[model samples]
Target: LGNQAKAAMNAGDLVSDDLIMGIMAERLKEDDCKAGYLLDGFPRTIPQAEALKVMLAEMGETLDCAVEIDVARDVILDRLTTRRTCSGCGEIYNVKSNPPAVEGKCDKCGEPVVQRDDETEEAISNRLNVYNDQTAPLVGFYKNEGLLLS
Candidate 1:
């Protein structure tokens, strides 16, 4: 779903709410989610949240709570700025939190670890702007539903 949305996002456009909801609906029906599951990076809008509630209700399930990890934007920016990813193994490392054994190298694959294009400051800022614009409202929406737990 992420890759499906990336092109539009890179063009500074949002993937339509219906498309995101459809992807979520299909993924939720997989065998892994039969016993309930935790959702993150989803339900970005009030409608999406409401639709999710209805969808789960149709399956005789419902969201019990929503968990939010509160982090400062500056901190998030700093963290993303230092992340290094390996193309060979797709392993990730953080310079501050989880540095590799050798500088500029992937410990697992011996490949050069590079910052991904999307992790660049500009790209990260764009993503943050979109999240703040479209997804931040969910904080209030979930709070009103008494499901927001930060």
Candidate 2:
């Protein structure tokens, strides 16, 4: 769903929560998910979380736990601000923490490392704002449902 959302954004289209939910519903019907599956980037919003509950109820399953990885906003900003990617290989590196062996060069192919426009401070802050507005409610919703583990 994250890739779908990213693709939609890159294409200048609105990503519908229903579409993402539909994809999740389809994936849940697969045999592997019948036993169990770890969802990394689904149920991002309260509505999606509720939709998931209904879907799982229909499948005679319930969520066992949900974990939230906590990180400081400043840390996120700092990390994103320094992120650089290789245009040739699409390999990502961090200037401050994990820079390539040669400055501004890709370690894999010696190609120039460039900062992705989306990784800029302004773009990152905008994305973070959207995340806070839309995705934050799932934390409380899951907590109320006793599904949140941390």
Candidate 3:
């Protein structure tokens, strides 16, 4: 999953569900996550959510809720397209909101800060399209399970 993630991101593609689920299963078994963990953007599809249910059941755990922070699509597009990251230190910046002191340079690491390939407008649009098609249904899936907070 680790190796495939970079290639997928570079291609503006989602990682295969099996790879993600496998990694997530292993991760949830770690000591730190044994207590609990916040999965920011996960279980994007109904199938993944179902897999999570089975996985958690096997672990004697259950998800409390799924929180959806709804933002306007245009706002999401603008935010992602303007996002930048430091090549060295991975500091985040935004062209509109939070820019580095030196243009195109990381304020902390003095390394080049540039837009990620996956953050390009076209790439983001593609991602949003995929999300709309494949991930949006999870809203209804979680809602039906009484675990959704939108």
Candidate 4:
């Protein structure tokens, strides 16, 4: 599900709710997700969160909890700035922290790796602004539902 969102993000664009929902619905219906699944990088918007509730209700399932890792924003900036992306496969690597086994090449796909413009400081600042505006509210939203764990 995150693949589509990642493709959108890699191009410096915010993924639309429709694209996110489509992929999420497909994954959630799969057999592997029946027992349990750990979801990350989802419900980035209030609409997505609301729609997820409706979908889960239809499936007779509910989120057990929403775990938030409360990291400082500056730390995120420092870490994300070093990220590089694979052109063939959208795998991410942090040059200084988790470099690929082969420098400038994807370890999994053998593709040329390059830094995404989206991870530039200015671009990351823009994304952070959007996160603050549209996504931060989710923390309180889930907290009110008694499903938030930090």
Off by over 4 Å in 2: 1-7
The lDDT per prediction is: 0.87, 0.88, 0.90, 0.89
lDDT of 4 at 124: 92
lDDT of 3: 0.90
Q: What is residue 22's positional error in candidate 3, in angstroms?
A: 1.8
* Residue pairs that clash (backbone atoms under 3 angstroms), model 2: none
* Candidate 3 C-alpha error for residue 145, in Å: 0.5
Order the candidate numbers by lDDT, best to worst: 3, 4, 2, 1
* Per-model TM-score versus the true fold: 0.83, 0.86, 0.86, 0.76
- In TM-score terms, candidate 2 sits at 0.86
N/CA/C clash count, model 2? 0
Candidate 1 residue-wise lDDT at 49:
85
Off by over 4 Å in 4: 1-14, 86-95, 98-113
After aligning candidate 3 to the native by TM-score, how far in Å is the CA of 117 from where it should be? 1.2
How many Å off is the CA of 9 in candidate 4? 7.7
Model 2: worst 10 consecutive residues (lDDT sum) = 14-23
> Among these predicted structures, which one has the highest lDDT?
3
Per-residue lDDT of 88 in model 1 = 89
Residue-level lDDT for 103 in candidate 2: 94
